[model samples]
Target chain A: MSDTKTKKKRKEKPPIEEPLLAPGHRACSGCGESLGAKLVMDAAGPNTYATCCTGCLEVFSTPYPESAWKMPWIHSLFENSSAVAAGIEAALIAQGRDKDVNIIAMGGDGGTADIGIGCLSGMLERGHNILYVCFDNEAYMNTGVQRSGLTPFDARTSTSPPGKRSWGNKTTKKNLPGIAGAHGIPYVATATVGYPNDLINKVKKALKIQGPKYMQVHVPCPLGWIHPTDQTIEIAKLAVLTGLIPIYEMEYGEVTRVRKIGKNRRPVEDYLKPQGRFRHLFAKGAEAEEELEKIRQIAEDNIKKFGLA
Target chain B: MARPRPAGYVAEPGSSKANKTGSWRTEKPVFLHDTCTDCRICVLVCPDGIIFGADSIYDADFDFCKGCGICAAECPVDDIEMAPEVR
Candidate 1:
């Protein structure tokens, strides 16, 4: 009998695995949105209260009889997660328990950048002590792929399908981070699902600050974007490396930190070719070249504006 | 008699654990622990949050893993591989 085996195994530390988001959620495999939510929730920790708008997160995490959230969470209307969070903040303040509680409002791009913009602006303007996270997958994913205000230029959706005369969506992504910063909030940042550590850091940083904070996390959708399920993180990284989705932070209307792409910056085609939504942009024609050049210019503009080089 | 419903609200948190999402997988990840480092990158990137364990002893909970192959795809040391799920 080998007594050394028993002695060596005497004190191995127990595994620590307590996710704030429980399993069995209906989010698709390799769903970037769910990963983003889990990262955010894990960062916020157990002593948090959250409100989710009616979008992919809310629908998938909380069906009629079950909820995946491990904290006190509320599901409200499609356009009022911010309002619900504001109300919760007010109630907590009146009860003198606001200082110890972390409040978060979660939504998809359609809920945050489009339909919910009014309430979100109000939440920011009124200086509510909360963090609002917009998981931007670039379209209205829960309701079949429809175009959203935050959808990037020339990306095809059900509503913006490319035809002989059409080049998908005509408008560029809305300046959401800029709009949030213009309100002069305490903290505003952008993150992506590919970089989990960075995403967690931003969420933790936002919770520590007082007053309103905003974070827009770029989440890839396997079902909607039509990329391979395993490539969610890879595609998300491509978005940043190509300098399209600028990762930066603002404090009180001033830029503080920007994730530099520098010499490792990649071309837009590496990103666009992988996504079916951007497939039309890669067609062998003058229109495709024109659209790609426009997308490249947009990335270059972002690099120049944020000093990402 | 009808069940007593109070304003259509759920009191239980994390109840989705009963849904058994693992059945959705057509492929499952197999870990080669010998080549594994203690990076925990696979644990962090898992969308389902079902990969558990600390250090180099990590493994996925097959009860909920949707087998997205992210763990294998993102493994820095090539410690994980996606294999076809066997009946």
Candidate 2:
């Protein structure tokens, strides 16, 4: 017994031999979606299957002759990743292997909050044993920065360009986590790539639960967001700290845990000024001030709704 | 003549490792090990996922390191600096 105790005490942290998401994929330098994908797969471990929609994640990781994923992965159309995952789960159940394997469905905001939302809703309503992860970069980044349903108000996109008669995007971001929680699933959570440990822990916890689980990870795109490539993590953290993005957990349509902003709450400009996409909002005009106030109000509303104070 | 694989499935998984992305790097991260705290934030933040180490010894596999500078930018101890690539 004493020798066993010594051995346990002397155990060292094991070195990582091979990342589940291997390197040499064609993701741009400092791409937050790739990091988020790696974190999710690392948390899910070796006995998991992943299905991805047609988006940047699928494109960059799986060019014609090569693939970065080290696990069993599949890709379907832009709007059927969740449906494909449901099929995988059904097959596993037929084989009496459902309990041993985990299923994950992944897509970008364009695929998740826009085109794939119907399939995602069906999967959630059917109560499949799967986790759906939405990598929300706030636009259709794979197709050259077109605006999507999750795009925030007054953010510039190729389609929503600011011109003589219009601001950037006219509509506010859809409350996707709320919509996911509305399905009364077992687990729903919002996370950002800024906090890696929190993100990993949430993924692990969601995988442990048996019912439908949803996670929307705020992955910043340096090219799309027009920020310095090295500033991806900083920009992501700023989004949370500025109260524009509230990190919280929901269980069965109720908020259970929230990452409190407290004294660290910053104004939205701290988050906006760094990205060139929001540059038009800073131009000198009374209209700009009004729009900035509206954006601030959105952040304030989020802080109040999630009780982040 | 041969038929193509179904849905273009990869016969060898993780074959992207063969594509050396290090050539895309304009700047390379130089690690100052003497002052390193071994927090491993560099490993966590790397989009390339090329850094690997354990027990206070961390280093990046230069073969796949795209030198995004995220590791250096996120390093709390300032032990990493993005220097211009010499070669």
Clashing pairs in 1: none
Candidate 1 residue lDDT tens string, A25-108: 999999999999999999999999999999999999998789999999998799999999999999998999987789999999
**Which lDDT value does model 2 have at B9?**
59
CAPRI quality of model 1: medium
Best by DockQ: 1
Q: Write the per-residue lDDT of candidate 2 for residues A1-309, one digit (tens) a residue.
A: 334434444456567767789998999988999999999999999899999999999999998888899999999899999999999999999999887788999999999999999999999999999999999999998889999999999999999999788889999999999999999999999999999999999999999999999999999999899999899999999999988989999999999999999999889999999999999999999999999999999999999988888
What are the candidates' individual DockQ scores? 0.54, 0.54
Model 2 misplaced stretches (Cα beyond 4 Å)? A1-11, B1-7
Instruction: Itemize residue pairs with steric clashes in candidate 2.
Output: none
